[model samples]
Target: MVAFGFTVANAVAAWFAHYDPVNIGWRLMFAFAAVPALVQLVGFLFLPETPRYLINHGREKEAQEVLHRLYDNDKEWIAYEMGEVAREMRREAILRQESGDEFVLRRVLRTAHVRKALALGCALQMFQQLAGINTILYYTSSIIRSAGVHDKITTIWISCGISTVQAVGTILPLNLIERLGRRTLVLSSLIGVVITLCMMGGAFILINYDSSKINPAQAYIGIDMNSTNTNKELLDLCFGFRNCDECVTSEYCGYCSLKEESSSLPTTFGQCLPVNSENIQHSLYGYCKDSMNNATAYSFTDTSCKTRFTALPIVIMILYISVYSLGMGPIPWVFNAEVYPIWARGTCVALSTFTNWTFNLLMSLTYLSLSQAITKHGAFFLYAGISFIGFIIFYFFVPETRGRRIEEIERLFMSEKEITPERNQRHEKTVSASVI
Candidate 1:
């Protein structure tokens, strides 16, 4: 449901970007953000209060009514559930009293089950970011362009298509979570993530090293290179590079190539020169400039080069988004919400959420610098390595929590004796009846 909003948003923004006059498409997109926010605000007014919230607030009648409907008016089931909630509440109150109202973090740190849950939650959330979803989400167009997309509008639409895949891909999990279970979904997702990242990395490697992309840059091949001595140092800043691939290594230089007829890769000798600050798509002043009056026929780009492997990122992106939506996209949030006891839920989840955002910041901040330092394909390889580790860790550590109650899930993190025989028997019966 959350994904649905942004699914439509990308296409809408594309339309606005293509058609809106006064160049206010971005402003309109920003304004349109409120439409969903307002709709959700109003929708929440009609949402039913859950049994836990109603019971916590002393709305026993409402809680009973909710449980009646949930458990199909089974008096014994309702009684059991109500009693469980009440008992958990009593335990929380007693803990609070015994701890002398210590900080929530301190309490969580002291509880064995919740501490383990906290560690799992934080690790999952951290890897979720370390997988580089944000890097793709925030810079899909840039990546697409690197994959050899030339036109701005085409890049926007392609990015929109990728987001739509992400949004639509989430629907399968909604249906599969109960069937396949959470652990299965997340583990499968991590495995696919690692494989797809490796595929993407390999595609980039191929693009970088293809023989057709090896057009060496001529230091003064273009007619626009003035013979005057005044700009000699400036010329060296760009012309020092020997090849099209290395030309972009210098931040100031843009690669301008004459593409071959049969291939996407540039063939003829190209030149490297200072990129135009005013309009980076072309050279500052050279044969490669976008102006029609230029002497040489050149395709100028500061950011990305033409390559045959362009289709690979698109294909890999779809696969990545599809697998990601099935698990890491939604399950971490789902699992973290249910992992800890009621008393520690808020504090521990907060820490997990903090881990999420901190890692999000870390990934976003480091991506550009990392790409520059190690090159883009190298960074993708590193992310693939991290994702492989995530797959291994999740397979061993993350438990299957389908149809399990919070107390049962809590028991998963504790020793066997902590689960009373009576409670275990009841839980077994419950699980046998409803294997959701």
Candidate 2:
């Protein structure tokens, strides 16, 4: 909430300072934000630490005191809960240290089930990050503007609103998670996401193909749209157009003809053409530079496409919020932390963390290249395809973790048994704890 409030305050302030300069509204908005931030800071200062953590860390006396302060009437029950948590932690820690001789990496790598869990956990993280979700979240406004949204400010605000809705709607899952199984939640969310992504792809296709009707605002390209003669000669003269600079015109003449003739517009035509016919043939591109002058050209406006359900973006945004909340929001931690046996849990968790960072690094370095090489629509389409594959793999392979104790999952992997007496005992022991 603090992060959200801070972001909103910063954006509103910047918007006001840029667009509503006379009113000094930016100052007021930031000043208002300070109130809640200050309140939160103060409130947090007085908040008690979780007794569970304290007990796990061997601060039993402190944990008891905190529990008593938190629940005066339930002190007896809380103490029993804290005792169980401490015992579980001690058992796990001792077993881990004993097996590894120092809780080191060598022991984990030697175990087959542990290695499998680590690999799967790491792969899950890699897949999630590589799906290109963050690129959409962080750059939605720029994406909309690039799509020819006329009122850039409004588009930005709408993006912010959509983000706010996503954040707000995510809290619902925290309430509904226990009621709905984890597999059910994740599967349903992914299915919804597939639908939403396809819709977005269709919208892009709509905008790209029917640009004359949807986003008629033509991109301004350099070079004269009406020039009778191509600028090939000037380009050759300016910089050796041909592979060989044998022509006398290629050398600096008294004045440059290229400067006089070159158009000031931006072109989708990637490179400055050489005088040779080969360069012209190799140009390999086509787009309407003349569309800027077309009267039928449409600009993205809340009012312009109003009757055509221009509101579809907003509706799709709501679906995005719902799908993300149910799927991507919870799946990472749930997958990486819960699927492995206790013996391999730490190793798998570490590998998963590493996988997330590695994939993030790859994405950060390659996003621009991907966007340029395949176009944004193509890149997102690829991501949607990858997500679809992940959805199918998970539906068949991922087990439901909800309402089941971690030790029960451990038994499934290690003992290969279905709810035996030993597994039930392990489950009962694991569930008696209150550790976070």
Cα-based lDDT for every prediction: 0.78, 0.56
What TM-score against the true fold does each predicted structure earn? 0.79, 0.64
For model 1, residues 1-436, the per-residue Cα lDDT tens digits are 6577666877877777765524687788778889988998999997788887899998999999988888889999998888877776766665566568588888888777778889999999999998888888777887887787877778889989998888889888888888999998899898888888888888877767741333344456544544553366766777665555456645677787664442543356677878877877787656676674643456777767767778988899889888888998989998998888766888888899999999999998888778767767888899999988888888888898899988678898986665778857754654443322
Q: Where does candidate 2 have its weakest 10-residue lDDT segment?
A: 247-256
Pairs with steric clashes in candidate 1: none
The count of backbone overlaps in candidate 1 is 0
> Candidate 2's residue-wise lDDT over 148-185, tens digit each?
45364577576777667766766778856778867788
lDDT of 2 at 233: 51
Model 2 gets an lDDT of: 0.56
Poorest 10 consecutive residues by lDDT, candidate 1: 210-219
* C-alpha RMSD by candidate, in order: 5.7, 10.8
